[model samples]
Target chain A: MGNDALNVEHSSGHSAAVFRETQDSEQFRRLKRKHRGFVLPVTAACLLWYFTYVLLAGYAPDFMATPVFGRVNIGILLGLSQIVTTFAVTMIYVSYANKQLDPDAAAIRDRLETKEGVR
Target chain B: MLHLAVTAPAAPGDPVLNIAIFGLFVAITMVIVFRASRNNKTAADYYAAGRSFSGGQNGSAIAGDYLSAASFLGIVGAIAINGYDGFLYSIGFLVAWVVALLLVAELLRNTGKFTMADVLAFRLKQRPVRIAAAISTLVVCFFYLLAQMAGAGGLVALLLGINDRVGQSVVIAVVGALMILYVLVGGMKGTTWVQIIKAGLLIAGAGVMTIWVLAINGFNLSTLLDSAVETSGNPAILAPGLQYGLSDITRLDFLSLGLALVLGTAALPHVLMRFYTVPTAKEARKSVVWAIWLIGIFYLFTLVLGYGASALIGAERIAAAPGGANSAAPLLAFELGGSVLLGIISAIAFATILAVVAGLTITAAASFSHDIYASVVKKGNPAPGAEVKVARRTVVVIGIVAILGGIGANGQNVAFLVALAFAVAASANLPTIVYSLFWKNFTTQGALWSMYGGLASAIILISLSPVVSGGEKSMLQGVDFAVFPLSNPGIVSIPLAFFLGWLGSVLDKKKESLEKQTEMEVRSLTGVGAEKSVAH
Candidate 1:
């Protein structure tokens, strides 16, 4: 998969010639481009949420200390917030990758299958 | 009508509730250990969970091992007594997880098999490097184990009403026995499960305490602050600086401790080894994310427990106890939640010590058997099952040594001992690990120099610091020692380690073809290169 992506870049300028001579396909290029965005953003968002939680605890002690229930301090709320954040980030990433990135990567993968079939 | 104060005499009883709670905890642990033993077959199974844990499970175990007695109890106690300064350790510890997530977790998981020395000596062809790393690993683990054992003793004494020495001895014997079982029977599988279960119970208990604390404070920010301020004589309970006796310098020292905790957690031999229990690098990453949530929540509860201790139990009581501020959380449980809750909390504390110490013992054993004995002395090949037997034997020796250390250090402040361990770890181990991972020119010579330099410098600085030097019984009590101002050595040692590592790497760049070796090393570490090359 990585080899195909690298080859696509190397053959971009000679797309017409390469497409004719080699089993280079349009679907594979699009798929590789699509999946590239999935991992980086998901990782970044998770880290961001984590740091934000830390910063909030460090800076917003008063707001965090505000008890929502009898004796339930704000720190508990902030701490529990990480659970929500983790789930939220993870769910969003999985959904986004499934909906957006994986299909594209799969399409490119299918193109390889068809190319191999032709050969 | 004025009610005159009547002094109540100290009440003495059989502490039946405490005994029952402790007995139940032991029974449960034994069941788990015995069950784990059923699955123990190969040495790999004993040492690395047969390398089968998912990222999340290992992550929890990491959290379990990482959240020590000091973290679970001492931080809360410190916060209760010293206010925001005390909470700094939690923040530091949490940030260190971020370090683990980003840099060390996956890398170490990918590089090492059982011990950290395996990773350190992967590229370097030096017996001295492996020996040095093993020694450092043992030293750090022993100090950490001593702190945990002492904590266990304190917990037992507090709950069972036994004399401190008896409590210490019992904890030593029980933990030693349990750890030996963990190694001989379940191995990594048993240890990992113990850590996971303990982490769960610990967080759940802390969560319960947090809810209780908030409920007692009426869930009112203003009211909570007002009460804390009124009781504490410092209205700045809501703000960072509103607390007393906390100056800028002290705050920075607290921050240094925090940095040490976070970074130190990643460097800890036991905690780092937990990552290797998983099969793949991706799982290792996933487990860390899980650990982040567990650790973050536990630390958050610690903040509440700290404030709760001050607001409800009063700082005076916390200070008056034999353990001083460190006893605040346990004491608060006793006062607020009654004996039942106290019993549970104390049992959980005991479990915390046992789980952490068991992890430490296993790591120390691995270092001794795998790194020093098998790899260094025997040149990496030994008779079948011999290494495993040696590891089990080493566990007994290490456990005994830890007990003696715990006994010698009993009645001393645990927070100081833990902090010293962190300082030493941050100084000695972290630099070597980070340099080896990232720096291309990190030769065996560089690793050797950095490890010894950081170790020696941290020891000297700590000996000269106020924590040891200014004490009445200190060797340097009457002598003038110009160590750094802060009692903790993180600020000095961390930077010093980095400098030594960098300097050594730079000087040795010409001695070897570092770039070529580092390229191959990175490929192996990342699992990006060919598999056949990796086997070599």
Candidate 2:
């Protein structure tokens, strides 16, 4: 099995071998766990915001239209807020993921490459 | 249902001005179509722009395809008449992309080669799952395509002063022909560029219109509100309609509609396919971020148009027009910018329909060719070039089906059909896709059960809804009650699908373990599981 693995690795090239061998690695497990944390909260927040707009527009029409401006209603404000929420969520996610998640994943990747060199 | 009175008598033949405008649009589209053909090459080139689209370019095309006639025309008209409730739809659409970005985009890019069915059925024995996914894809795409075609026909009739049927058939034929040429000649590369350019122009036009609208209202949000309030005869411009305002029922309906819009985008086969155009999962993520920004800005402009329509043209005038509130934006443009700008705006609307319908057609073709024909029927032995050829042929077949569906359902009530499509998408596709990507225990049986269950339930409920059953007029109208209110099944069906998927997965755990070998299939898909299992 080990020889077969090496032969397949030789044929497909190093990157493929690394990708295959890392499937059950601690690094992959950690990345997947981190991704879950990020994705769940973000998705939940978006869904919550979406429902809030709809609920406010439907049930509290008067409150939504509480007249921020002359004729601009609360519905319009909430509706437009959807656009703001989209960008806010996106920017926050990108910055956080790049700063926190990517570096950790990168460190693991470097370790894997160095291990491959030792092998 | 409103018919134009045609206040002015017909002066002579062909309405020369209308002919000139229509002719010019056709001429330009043809030139662009042929020029785009120059980029077409292999099957990959046809389906995914040769996987060469930069994040920004694909993002623009995604925005273009996403902003259908519904967003550009329907939301504006809805806002013009319904005020705040109308803008709710735009907000729902914009926020939906968040789901696309965080949950579906990177996963879809990593999993599937071409079609969404490929992603869903990735770990499963492909045949049954592929067949079911393909059917759902075709059904959803067909319904959506019909709505686009009908919108095209209506837009032409509204703009050119022609018989509605004649206008519709012309649009059907023209769009069908162009879509076929787009797939057969231009492929994905051409399609992407066309989508990108169209999206850019559409956004620019919306921005221009928004600025003009605010300028007309002197950029005073309060004054604009006062004018809208005065014009609308409602104290608040955002209040609910004559029928639905100040009611719990209406509020629930609004929330359901929003849920459908936000969740449905992640599930849409065509929209999901666009993420694959980017090279890596990282680029896929970046493209979605860009798409969110572009779509957000464009929707904000929609709010301006909605308010602008009421302030400038009067809601009553819009309500009285042939298509009722839907014509508000175009009419407002005519009043604000005169005939030339009206012509330009109208032309852009027409272009919007073509570009969207074309994207839908290509996605549908890929689903049929890749999922059903190659994967399921042929057991993945598609002889390399055979799959692409099959895909091109499917484009023509699907295009014809869409044209026919449009004609059959032409005047029957298109708005209702479109809402139903969104409902079905949110219910059937969203749950299955999300579970597959995120849930490790999601079994083939669970996916199959949830997808078919969601698809069947939404379709049945919609068919029995007041919108389709004609309210009080039909024989079963009194007895056959709508399972869900708001005529859209997203609220009920989406949750139902998720529950079913969870139940199926939980109950079938022992059987699921029998297929533990499938965990290795994930590596084949994400390039992670394959190496460990395949000795490579």
lDDT score for residue B352 of model 2:
77
| Span of 10 residues, lowest total lDDT, candidate 1 chain A | A1-10
Q: Compose the digit string of candidate 2's lDDT tens values, residues A1-119.
A: 01112123323334534554565676667676777889898789778877766666566655765766655556666666678778988998888767766666556545544665411
Q: Report the C-alpha lDDT of model 1 over B13-115, residue by residue, as the tens digit.
A: 2367766786797788778878866766655666787778887788789888888877777778777776654564566677566556655766676556677
Worst 10 residues of 1 chain B by lDDT: B527-536
Which candidate ranks first by TM-score, i.e. highest?
Answer: 2
Residue B325 displacement (Å), model 1: 2.0
Alpha carbon lDDT of each predicted model: 0.66, 0.71
Query: Model 2: per-residue lDDT, tens digit, B417-466?
Result: 56767778888888888777677788778887888888998888777666
DockQ of 2: 0.35
Fnat per predicted structure, each in turn? 0.03, 0.47
Q: Tell me the lDDT of model 2 at B351.
A: 71
